[model samples]
Target: MNTPTFRNWQSVQSEVLRRIHAREWPPGELIPNEADLAIEFGCARSTVNRALRSLAESGLLDRRRKAGTRVAAQPVAKATIDIAVIRHEVEEHGAKYGYQLITRRIAVPPVSVSGTMKTRAQDKLLHVRALHLADDAAYAVEDRWINTAIVPDAAAEPFDVLSANEWLIEHAPYTHGDISFSAVQADQGDAEVLGVAPLSALFAIDRVTWDNAAAVTKVRLLFLPGYKLRTQL
Candidate 1:
C-alpha cells in the first residue's frame, strides 16, 4: 500500500480509495502496513487500523494477519456524499432565501483560531462573515475562516453572489468533516448579527474540514432564536 499523507483518518480513507481507483495501488497490491500509515498520519495506530478495517469490510481491500492487507481484486463498494444546498433546505420548508455578505478579509489567524485548526501561529485565513435569511428575516449568522494555505483560491473568489457555505460545497471536495452542535446564549455581537436580543437562546453549529495533509476550513453558524433543526437517522 502507498502511504497516504493526510492528517485525518477520513481524509486518509478517501485518498486511499482515490489511489485505488486511479491504480496507484493496483488491485491485489499489498498496502503499506498500519504502523507506517500511523506515522504518516501523525495519529495513533488504532486510528489507521479503524480506517483500514472499514475499507476491508466494504470490500475495497482484503485484510489478513501476518500476510497483511491488499487491495481487493474486485472492489465491491463505493460511497457518495449528497451535499445539500442550504437554500434548498430553507425553501423546502416554504421559506424564501436571502443572503447578505457582512464582511470579507484576509488576516493572520488568532491564537485561539490556530489552535482549533491545528495550524501554525502565522497562518493566514480568508475570513467571511454573512447572514442567511428566510422570508426576508434573519435565519442565521455565519462566521467562517478558510485556510488559505490549504485552498488558496478562496482568496480570489467574489462571495457576494454566493454564501461561503454554498461556495465551499462546490469548491472543496472532502470525504467527511468534524461537526459539533451546541446551544448557547447569544452574545451582543451574535445577537445583533442574527437580529435577536442579547442573551437569547440560540443554536450553534461548528464544523472543521480537512483534506489529506491540512485543515481546510472552520465555521460557526448561529441560528436565530426559535430556529429548530430536525434530522432522522
Candidate 2:
C-alpha cells in the first residue's frame, strides 16, 4: 500500500473516523492496537493514541484497560443541519407555509435557560414564541430565547415574517454548540400548537448556540409526532 499520510492529530482522527464509518472497523470489532496503527500510518504511537482517545471521548469507540479498543455498538454520529428556510421545509412537503408570532418580549430567561447560559439573574433576553404552519396547520412550535447581550440587533429585527430559527442562523456565525434530544410527553400548550393529544410523545431537542466567546442563544424545539431525525454513517 502507498505510505499512509497524516500531518497532524486532526488528520489521524479524521482517517480513523472515516474507517469506522466505512465499517473497516465494524461495530464490536477490535481495532488494531496503537503500535500496529502507528506502524501502518507511519506515525508515532502517541499520535495514533491521541486519535483513538478522541474517538473514544466522542462515543465512537469503546476502550478498555486491557481488552483494547473496539468500535462502539451504537456510535454517536455527528449531524449537520444547513439552516434551511422554513419555506423550503414546508414546500418540500407540498404545503403552503406561514409563521405566526405568538409573543415577543424582553424579559429575564427562565431558570432552566439561565442555568444553561450561566448569566446573571437580571440579564435581559429576547423571549419569542412562534408557530410554524404547513398549509394553515401547525407543524412545529419554536420557543427560543436570544441572549440580548450577545446579539443586541435581534431586539430590533422584526420576526413577524421571518422565523427566529432561520434568522439567527443567518445573522450569527457560531463556532460551536451543544445539542441534546429526548422524547417528552407534550404539555397543554405544546399539544394545542402541534395538534396532538396531551401527554403524547413528542421529539424534544434543546440546543445551545455560541459565537466562540459567549453563548448567543438557547432554544428548545418541540416537534410534532412522527417527526423522524435520520442520518447515515
Which candidate number has the best TM-score?
A: 2
Per-candidate TM-scores read 0.63, 0.67
Candidate 2 segments exceeding 4 Å error: 1-85
Q: Mind giving the per-residue lDDT tens digits that candidate 2 earns over 93-193?
A: 79999899989999988788888877787888899999888889887788998987788789998799898888987787788999888999999988988
lDDT (Cα atoms) of all candidates against the true structure: 0.84, 0.85
Whole-model alpha-carbon lDDT for candidate 2: 0.85
- Show model 1 residue runs off by greater than 4 Å: 1-83
lDDT accuracy of residue 172 in candidate 2: 74
What TM-score number comes out for model 1? 0.63
Write down the worst ten-residue block by lDDT for model 1. Answer: 77-86
